[model samples]
Target chain A: MLDINKVKQRIESLKKLPAIGSKSVKEVLEENGFSRRDFLKWSGALAVSLGLPATFAPVVADAAEVSNRLPVVWLHLAECTGCSESLIRTDAPTIDDLIFNYISLEYHDTIMAAAGWQAEENFEEALKKFKGRYVLCVEGGVPTKDGGDFLTIGPDAETGLSKLKRTAKDAAAIIAVGTCSSFGGIQAAYPNPTGAKGIHKVLNKQVINVPGCPPSAKNIVGTIVYVILFGQLPAVDNFNRPKFAYGMRIHDLCERRGHFDAGEFVEEFGSEEAMNGFCLYKKGCKGPYTFNNCSRERFNQHTSWPVQAGHGCIGCSEPDFWDSMAPYEEPLANHKFESISADATADKVGITILTLAGVAVAAHAAISAIKPPKE
Target chain B: MKITKKIITKIEGEATLKLYKKDSLIEFAEIEFWQYRGMEEYLKNRNYMDACVINPRICGICGHSHLIATSKAIENALNIKITKKAKILREITLGLEIIQNHIKWFYITLYPSVKEINYFKALEFSREIAKIIALIAGQFPHNSYAVPGGVTCDLTNLEIIKVKNFLSKMFDKYQEIIDINGKSEDLEILFEDIPKETGKGINKFLVLGDNLYFKSNGNAEFIKEEDSISLNKNVLYKGSFYEVGPLARNLENYLIKKVYEKYQDSIYTRIFARLYEVNLIFQYLLKRIDEIDINEKNYIKPTKKSGKGVGIVEAPRGSLIHQIEIEDEKIKSYNIIVPTQFNLSNGTKESPSPAQASLIGEYEKQSDLIFKCFDICAVCVSH
Candidate 1:
């Protein structure tokens, strides 16, 4: 229950923050040949996703109109730049919503025109200019092993871990964008040769984790919008993720739940059963166990998600999903690759094994196929 | 001349260019990639199907390319037989990926670098194309809908209608972009004051992937990765460096023919080749989408699960190869030879990589624009 008065009061003061360069958000969008209507419609959709009433569109519109855009320093570490691609690919690029109108992005490695020493200067200058003001948005995990030489940054070649430390030391808020930065991601899975860890683990500050192999633009934007609107991190789950976006289980809101209840399942990919859009539980759909709004918000401008396209969810939004969520073809709890029977036992999915008979098999059948299950 | 090191940003991942200048002339260049996620290394000990999900993360812009490539690799490893309908559908989606990738590269990367203004509207339309992709495959950038057999999603005639409607709106948006940006086709519009015939790197081509328009040279049929394949960033085909991407597609477009006649294999020929390919693919897709018989099957599972095979695709950047050695459905070793490696391998006076050879004889400062022409993908090469 947020107080409307305090929200209004906070917005009034936050609106006075200094703008980047001479260009207002409106001017930048227009100069870029973008219509304000598209941005407005997008932000309004973001409000709806934020659980604010559809009527609250004007409230957001009012705040965004006057709110001085904060500088966002986006960093890439041991990553695929998928998160950057995910964030910058869309017009608005929300984590589905506000890289455009709400923030002044001073330095993003992928989108910025400059490179080499000039690019490195841009990063350093942004840190100096917006010291303690800009939000440090990291997109990958930090490698802290063997003196962290596995991943280095800039011409000076400082370890990625140190670069992050230097950058995060003076940030207003720190947001780890994707699963790599959120939970050490794929690199952290299986042997973890680079010794990568989530930014929250590496950093001393209270880092907000937005875990998804590549989280939807809406969820990414939704978290940033929460910070912009409330001037603080929204309520977080146990994983330090903003609850506004990660509160519900994908199973509860899944479009194919009825099939799961009816005991109908997709036995194989592209089968008549699959074409019928039966539940993917037997086919290893992680929807029943995973959390996030993929089914509702979708991806690439809310067009579709993995399950909707007839593939099983990989439980990507959860922590260490690369390790835990695999044997991606089978259910999370029970690695019964041999059966689609009625009395199948769930495997070792730790946090939320949606329908797999509830038990934590932290490191279960993920490493097994012809071999026996792990202890 | 002192060696000038330029850190090339604004790629799928970060990269650096080491320019060896002699008397103010760029004599040779070496591009370096710093991070390696060990993409192939991690895929080991995992199930054969997992590579589809993991490989796409290698590069967000070309995730679908990786997905299709990985699916094909696994299918090859397992000797899967897919229907004709699946092949067409894969082509359609892959074409969509190349189209959206070109638009983003043109608008987001190329436009901003050259014009110094952000044309943000068309990016929305590009996402609309990604929506079309998501309609068929579930997600863009990362969705493992393409399995060992065929694809996961089965489309109906009604869904095809939705895709068409979206395409119509996309056409209108592109019209808006061309209207605002004035469809500048000249090389100056892209490189901004850079002279003609500047980035004419080694005038050779390589297209390993089989596409309908581009005739494959039968290079891939006889060679296998296991017998002899470089395990590093640099790759060689029959002991020579070759360029890939649209430039290598060798499209027989009138404009491309004229451009090549004028500038040879310079940046103009290379860049125009991509734009021309996008136009060709877009037209082909419009016709092909209407021809999709919803009655046809989309997938067929493989018979065998233990073997070695390679999957190759002409990604937005260039030729992408996925090599696999699977034992009993579990990956024994996975090797991915991405395109940038071919274009950006170490170069010398006698023999040079495509992009590297392009840099020779150019001035030091012109290296950035010239390098961007290749669309270097750092993560893909490293992965």
Candidate 2:
């Protein structure tokens, strides 16, 4: 449903007037001791990550070269700045993250110089000048209660809700950068005091939801790069998430699948089974039901993800994961899934969901076979 | 009187400083954080282990601090006595997180306010340090790898060697940039414009929680919260203002002592204290990383899962406290008092908060510098 022509038109109309001493991605890479070959290799890897063919590496490289012409306005809302922090710390120093440096970042409070009236004026001017030519990246959720005064901005104390709406009005592409913006995150759980909700819930338009507590920087940066590369929105799922990244469940690709299928499980935190890197099914991994690329792409520069670090996948990338994925250390069998019950095993759930790996031995990995609840 | 309202950006979220100037000096400054997410309120009735995951969402930059605090609180509540190896891993991750945060604070947050130096180099190094974290704690900013019993990570010798390599590379970069040594000329270059003698908040300092690098088992019992004009809860020690951060932690260090004695509790001391603390922590972690016995158990199963407990941790900003009371296997109450609340309490004109007091006698631009000197987190303060 992404209109490629509209994105192309916006790219063509990027004639606004803000001079940010931008550098070309190639120049930046070379300046930072990376060679031209490194740039091409990184571009190729990025193309692979974006699910584009190896032949599209040149197209991706072309996107990086002209990425500086794009204006980005990153907004912080009723959530932590993890997504923004994650963006800045996105350091394989790869082609994926280099897109950030080259993009004309018009208004991001984290790295932008201006504050108060200068900041407010710069924000106002960019929206006016760039109009429909800027990419808007929002990091948190919107609080709709108390007429949206819970979060305010600048010297005039403008409401954060209004700032988001105003910026989103003319954005060439709107990206809900984190889970907070995409699915209301933790603040919308149980007794939601601030009445916090996802950006899409309040806005009239659709946004590309890149959901994660602090999503893998590669995924976050890759989404942005996808926009600049093809000049169109990436193919998305039912949740408006890019299919390349969020298409498969984390369980499908989890390295611990053999352990789960073999009926070996970590009974407790420091148990022998845990040290051996056994399946964390008994320890309550949400990886099976959780849809994400954390198992594949990993985090912090392809180093290690949650499961590799020895904890169960917390399912941070799923919608309303905070509420739905509660009693965190317990299995999801207790939840109100139609096919699942308290005594159900991964094998049963795997069978019910045709796509999930048939966990033939999940019944053997259950509570009775494993360590029972200790008082 | 000339009143000027300015929104302080580029820190962990933003703050509005309403300054009232009499002649040239600021007479009284009011700091307001309009952002509020009811962190403690939503935490109510959540499952006990759930708090360890949810509490860290309070602030992205210092989530490790919250994770440590929340994890420790659950440990204290449920009588979960983790192995020493587990403690070491937890402390290692926490230390690296501080280094990562300080790297950003120095380059991304504090540096640009002073100069236009390209800080991406520091960010690159910080990721090396963060990779070390991901190696241990899964991820940075919001990794809930630290559970109550212990951390989830079981380190390999390869990971240990990788951590050492990262630390070596990190220090190699650190040597190039930060050197607050009394003999070092870097301080003059970094804080060239600002009057180094300026910033003197409530001179008193405080530190809470058991620490890894520094020695502090300060109590959170004396802490109290009162209503303030700012959206942040006004935190006080026995109902009075006190400073709580790096300057509080390291007053006696050779690198910071000379400067501290020269400009007691000023921005120079505060900034140097943080910078020097980075130097000290990096050295400490280098040695501490060697002490990890991977053969030892990472955790111990708790006997009880219900009780009242408090967890205090010295986050990058300052002391972070998480108090929890679990009843019938659920969180009956959860309270979080972040470091920013201690630093920036918009108290009455006669008696402002520690960092607020620092802004009282400065010009507009310098006040922004001084306020950032405290390194307050608007997100944490409201949470």
> What lDDT score is found at residue A241 in candidate 2?
89
What lDDT score belongs to each candidate, Candidate 1 first? 0.74, 0.78
Backbone Cα, N, C clashes tallied per candidate: 15, 0
The CAPRI quality class of candidate 1 comes to medium
Name the Cα RMSD for model 2: 4.7
lDDT of 1 by residue, B1-383 (tens): 67987777777777767888999999888777777676766687778888988889888778888998898888888888787767777887898888788777776666555566544554565767887887888877788888888888888888889887776666555544332222544334655576778889787777888854565654765432321122236677777778888877764666677778899999877877776666666666677767777788887867786999889888888888888999988898987878878787875678887888888998886777778888887777656
- Candidate 1 local lDDT, A1-375, one digit each (tens): 777677778778866777776767666556555576776786687788788877667667655654445677788998887776666545233323234423635787876656668788978898888788787789988987887877866777688899999999999899999999999988887657788889998788999988887887667767776777777887887788887788777877888888876777888888899899998877787775576877777777667888998888898888777776778887754553442211212232333343223222222333222233343
**Native interface contact recovery, model 1:** 0.69
In candidate 1, clashing pairs total 15
Stretches of model 2 off by over 4 angstroms after superposition: A1-23, A91-93, A336-375, B180-185
Worst lDDT run of 10 residues, candidate 2 chain A, spans: A339-348
lDDT of 2 by residue, B175-222 (tens): 666653433355678766777889788888888866676757356788
**Chain A accuracy as TM-score for every candidate:** 0.86, 0.84
Cα shift from native, residue B97, model 2 (Å):
0.9
